[model samples]
Target: MIASMWSLLAERRDFFAQLALEHLAISGVAIAVALVLGGLFGGLMAEHQRMAKPSLALVNFLYTIPSISLLGFLIPFSGVGNVTAVITLTMYALLPMVRATYTGLSNIDPTLIEAARGMGSTDGQTMRRVKLPLALPYVMSGIRSMATMTIALAGIASFIGAGGLGVAIYRGITTNNAAMTMDGSLLTALLALLVDMVLGFVERRVGMRGTEGRATNRRMAATFAAVVVVGALVGVVRALAPATSPAIRVATKPMTEQYVMGYMLKDLIEHDSGLTVELTEGVGGGTSNIEPAMESGEFDIYPEYTGTAWNAVLKKEGAYSEGLFDQLRQEYADRLGFEWLGMYGFNDTYGLVVRREVAERYGISSYSDLAHVAGQLRLGAEYDFFEREDGYRALCDDYGMSFGKTMDLDIGLKYQALAEGQIDAMVVFTTDGQLSTSDAVVLVDDRRFFSSYLCGNVVRSQVLEEHPELRQILSKLDDTITDEDMSAMNHAVEGEGREPEDVAREFLERKGLLQ
Candidate 1:
């Protein structure tokens, strides 16, 4: 595993290097801010007996909020990017910093302070020359804790457009590639350890500065100053990087198919229209984030399913029926100001699947067929599949399925579970790339409980008004991809270890859509 990780690191050094830089930039800014503000507030609170308890309580309360929720709350203000990630992570670091500073300072011996006063030192002087120096170790401890956490959280920042190792991790999960996940995780872990070690060295050197000569202390301070300056420069550069010109921001939900579709859209739009397309794939919040982002012009376009927009967006009940597209188009335009574009000519809906051998043995060709044998089988499904309106409950109620046991598994791992016979059946997407590679057979939806999930580009209505030519260029994908085409493209990327952009470019070139 270590050898494989090293190989992966060597192969993707350039990509990983930039990701590491981004991670450093993010964590650096957050730690710097937390160190100053948190240390100051903590020190002040330690002296202010009346304010200490309430302020610490507030800091503790802030710390209790989940990282994801804090990130979501900041999205409206920071607008989804490195800035948001920095702000969220900075907030997370505050409590530890404050507590460490307070604890360290409060534990200082009062006799030393009295001696300083007896030597005619003022309160401020005593704090600076004696108390602060004594508290340096504790403050360093806080900084160390914040530094480690900042690095770890920076990986998750990729979900909100804060590019870091988390991007690699998400890409790996979406593609079901273990090597890629390990590549990102291992690097992030190593990076955290490096930061901790560096901080520890700084802490020890600073603590020993007084015992050493003035020259050594000056040299140590200079080294620390240089490090801080470099970190600040990286953060500034990342924050001020120029946006691509004439670019339409495109987003995608968290899945392999969405990523493939995102790449396809980027390729075709760039080829036909010569527009710079900024694609942000695998948006963590899915439609919940994408829908609001489109409405707010955070992004210009994304691929969305008709049924998902129908049920999740429209908040309507009942199974899908005909005229779903028309309703979605009209309602989106009227209510959400989004214009639905051409369909990809595929229905990527959910289906209950079992190993081909199991299906054949039980003569299960449809949902009705499975119902008779469901009691004898154990089922597995993605966690979200059990929560969707047309998910486990609706499926079971409609098909009268009563499995012996049911389990909610990670979507990425469900294929492996079913393949290993840990599950007799699983819920799968109709157009999943894995379907072609796996020996699983999707049962027919005899009761039609699930809705049609016809997919296509959804853009803000105003974006179309401005870039009228975009409609024509994007329409090139209309009725272009069949279920087989999508499945094959997915397989190429997810199974064959090919890049999504490569697969998309190949398809477009083969179709004469790219020059």
Candidate 2:
């Protein structure tokens, strides 16, 4: 285990660095924006007696909404990515800074303001020389809180394709790799600590220097000058840049959407034909990642589940099967100009997984047994499973079973909880490629509640015409992957600490998909 973890960490060192940088960038930008906006609002509230209660109440209300929920609500308008993540983080960070500013400014000595006025100072001069200087420490305190909040919120931003240490953690959880999870958590904590210390030192230094009264005005002028210069350079670059690229670009769902699909295909497509295939992996899970990219022409190829494409992509709602797959394929080809490239030889069906020991003790051999014992078992599942139209809620309603305990966990953590015996059962993907190695048993779905989730590639009709050979290569891989093969391949990347690209290449070569 130690050797495997070391190898995995060594392989992902660059990714970790990139994740750290992304986290810092997102957090820094959000905190900076919060500082300016929150600071200004706080100052205004401090001066105006009537605005204080309403403004404070508003910031406090925003602070109460869960970060992830807020991100989800923003998805329709903003779509997923760094933009949504940053905006949410910025809003979340505002409360602490605004509250601190309000408290700091409001608490400043009225005597100091009176003294400044008595010295023949104007109202603006009294604010600059007395109240503002007295409130510096309070402002710094708010900034510190804002910085911390930003760091915490940035971690959650990974779900929306905002790259950060959270992505690493989420990946680890989904794959049930404890080492990866620990690495991500440790790194995030370290980043937060480092930022706090640096900012703490700066805050102290600035507080000690005292407010220069004129420093804010000077800083504002410098900032305006910098923005003007930067804008001019950006305009010049845009004018000089070429408008077209010769390489064929392929867009795919983010990493979380279809897990390993795009990652698996990255090398296969690139090396097979020497084509410059651009892979755009969505960070958001299936629906959010696949639809927008496909509709926007941002992606040319993405793997979509038969069930998802049927119900989600095609807007056809009913029970699913291999037949639904063909129908959806034909529908998409005719209406959406998208081609279904056939199945990848395996169906990653959803099933109820129970600890082997628990199954043995109860003699629970099938879905019927689970229904009978449902009240005795604890269930663990991902958030979407509870809310999606055809998710766990529907399944449970059909079964007429209520779990004794239900734990909301990320897909990755569900496996861990089940393995640790913390949960009696969990929703699991059938072809996860790790079940064979784990001590869990998937119950037979006698009721056939789950739809077929055959793995396959889908591409834009135009891209297929341009790169017909690519389609043929990918088609040859259809239905060739068995459950064991997928599990093993997944293990190589998520378990053994190998790169997805390298694993995909080896699989293709071994299968003769690559010449």
Candidate 3:
């Protein structure tokens, strides 16, 4: 176990370093942006009595919304990655700073303002000299609060593939591996604590400048300048470092195919060619990821589901045909500037899964059969399904079936909940490895409510045009995975407590997909 832990850490050293850097970058940027915006907004509100209540109320409301839900909502507009994470963190940081600024400015001595006015100081001068100076401490306090909030929020950004300590934590939780969870949580807490201490020290120093000597201020300034210079030099060197070799940039989505295939392709590509492979994991699921990354040239290659591309992306809702996958591939290339790298050997279709005993008792075998017994079963589904135009809600409506209860759970936790009898049924991916181990029966979609979810790679047109050999390499990976293979691989991570990357590598080696 110790050896395995060490190996995992060593393998992910660079990835975790990148994650830490990204976390810091996001938190720093968000705090800075929030400080500026909040100060301005607070100043305006303080100046106008009429605007105070409404402004505070609005910011306060935003502060109350859960950070994860806000991040998810922002995905469509900002897409995935650092931008979305930074923006969400910024918004979260805003309220504290705004309130602090308002309080500090409003509580400033009215006598000081009057004295400044008597001394012929204009409103602007009075504000600059009297209001700002007195409010500096409060503003710093707000900044401190924002910094704390941003650091905490940045960890959750990993869910959207923003990359940070949260990535490790989420991966651990999904795979049910306690050690990874502890490692990630510890690192994240330490990062937050260190940042808080640094910021607190800066705040204290700044607040004490009024009582301190000019010599002390001068020394502090010089120290800050020296640190900045050294940091800049280090950044320059890192940026100038040459690319060692050809690298494959694979784009993937969070918690889905991108999570699975990213690891699979990374080890395979690196081992086979002895070249670096960069993975750009995106935020959303299949329907949200594939085309946009391909069109924007943000990703070189990624896994895509044929059914999702057709029904969700193309808006072609109809019966599935044998040649539909090929037809969609050609259409996507012609219309969307992407190349459909031939299919991988698995179908990750939607399955309506229930406890085996329940299924046996009810004699439920298909969707049509589900209608008769629907009144007795409760349903658990993903949040997206509830909101989707043609998702589980619509499916139930179409079948004229009503569930006894409904609940929403994260995709990773759904299986555990089902096994624990939290819900009678759940909509799961057909290729999920847990089905074989758990006493769950996947009801046949005989009515064909779901579209084909055949897994495959989709490359940006430019990537396809630039590296023709990539097509050949990826094509060779086609029809390589099976239902059992997926189940086994999932079990290695989600069941047997193995890391996702390890499971991915082991599968590739077993299938001879890796050299």
Candidate 4:
């Protein structure tokens, strides 16, 4: 496994290197802020005994908030991307710094402080010359821990649409690529270790400076200063880098089909319109994040589904049908200033799938058939399925079904769980790559419980007016993709390890939509 990891690293050094720099920039900023804020707060607490308990309690409370929970909580206020990520990391890094400094200052010998005072030292002078110097070791220890934890936590920033090694990890899991997952995990661990080593070396050097000499101390300080300056410069450059770009920005949800379709649009836009397109893949929370970004003009276009627009965007209930398409389109334009274009000609709706043996034994082939045996079977689905308004409960109520047990499974692990008999049935999407080859029976939605989710390109109306010619180019995808084509493309990326762009490019050329 280690050798395979090294081989993967060698194959993708440039990819990992870019993400590593982003991780460092994010973690660095958070650590720097924590150090400053924590130092000030620690100093204040040390000076005031009354302030100590409350300050510690507050940070401790923040520290106890789960990382994912904190991120979800911050999204409405801060929106998405780097700002939310940095705030999350800084909050987590604070507790260590505050406690360390407070402990160090409080533990200082009163006799030593008195001797300095007896020598005609002012209270300020005693703190600066005597107490602070003695507490350096504790502060260093805190910084070391704070820096390490920050680096490790920074990987999660990618999960929320910020760039980092977590992109590789999350994408790998979504694509079912083990090597990619390992590559990301390996990179994060290496980055954390590297930061820990650098801090450890500096802490040791500072500790030994008094015994070593003024000249050695000066050299050590210079080395540390140079490192900090370089890191700060890199971060500043990244934050201030000119985006002077006129490229049309596109975004995608974190799914294999979306990745392929996003690349197809990007490729076709560049090919036919003679315009640049910058595609941002895997935009975290799907419509919840991307829709707001679109409204805010952070993105110009993204692929969306009809039922999602009807239910999630418009807040209308029941299944989408041909009669509702016009209303769906008009409401989007009226309410959100958005336009739907380039219908992909596929129904990527939900399905209830069961192990073939279970279906055969129970004679279950539709929701009605399953309803009779549901109480004897265990059902599994992703977390969202249970929480969605038009999801689990609605379906169960419609079909008058109740499973023996319902398991909340990760989107990726449902199939494995079904195959292992941990679950007798699971929820699936019609175009999921795994469905093409899995030995499972897809039960018909006899009662039409779930809504139709026809896919399309959703564009901001303002962008259409600005680049009127872009409309014609994007329409090339209208009614082009069928369920079979999409399922094959998804399978290529998820099941066969083929790149999404390569699969998309091939399909477009085959359809004569690309040169």
lDDT of 3 at 230: 96
TM-scores for all candidates? Answer: 0.90, 0.86, 0.87, 0.93
Q: Per-residue lDDT of 217-320 in model 2, one digit per residue for the tens?
A: 46855896899689668868987886454355454443332455665576667666757765544455656555675666656777777876776667665657
Compose the digit string of candidate 3's lDDT tens values, residues 1-515: 56755666677788667767877877888988898999999999889979999999999999899987787688767776778888998889999999999999999888988999999999999998889989988888888777877787788777665777787777666566656666677667778889889878877766665545546867988998899789878988987898887677776654534466788878766766646788765344545644564566555677877777776677776644547877887888788877777577778777798888889999988888888888898899877777655577668877888888889887677878888999988898776756778788888877777766778887777865766667677777788888767767777767676666777777777877876
TM-score winner among the candidates? 4
Off by over 4 Å in 4: 1-4, 211-244, 273-275
- Lowest summed lDDT across 10 adjacent residues in model 1 is found at 205-214
Over 1-515, each residue of candidate 1 has an lDDT whose tens digit, in order, gives 67866777898899889888878878888998998999999999889868999999999999899888888888776677678888888888999999999988999999999999999999999999999999888889988988998898788787776688898898888788778789999889989999999999877767675545656978878897999889778868976887555788999887888888888888888877757998887777678777777777899999988888887888888876657667778988999899988678888988888988899899999999999999999999876677777778888888787899999886678898998999999988888889878988888887778888888889998989988988888788888888889888888877887777778888888988887
Residue range 202-260, candidate 4, lDDT tens digits: 77766664555657879878897999899779868976896554579898887889989
Candidate 4, residue 469: the lDDT equals 81
- Among residues 3 or more apart in sequence or in different chains, the pairs in candidate 2 whose N, CA or C atoms overlap within 3 Å are 173-412, 174-412, 251-299, 251-300, 253-282, 254-281, 254-282, 344-479, 345-479, 433-487
Compared with the true structure, model 4 gives a TM-score of 0.93
Rank candidates, TM-score, best first: 4, 1, 3, 2
Judging by TM-score, tell me the better candidate of 3 and 4: 4
Q: Is candidate 1 or candidate 3 better by lDDT?
A: 1
Best by lDDT: 4
**Candidate 4 clashes between residue pairs 3 or more apart in a chain or in different chains:** none
- Worst-scoring 10-residue span by lDDT in model 3: 282-291
* Model 2 misplacement above 4 A: 1-11, 118-120, 208-259, 272-282, 296-300, 333-337, 397-400, 460-477
Error of 1 at 354 (Å): 2.9
Which 10 residues in a row give candidate 4 its minimum summed lDDT? Answer: 205-214
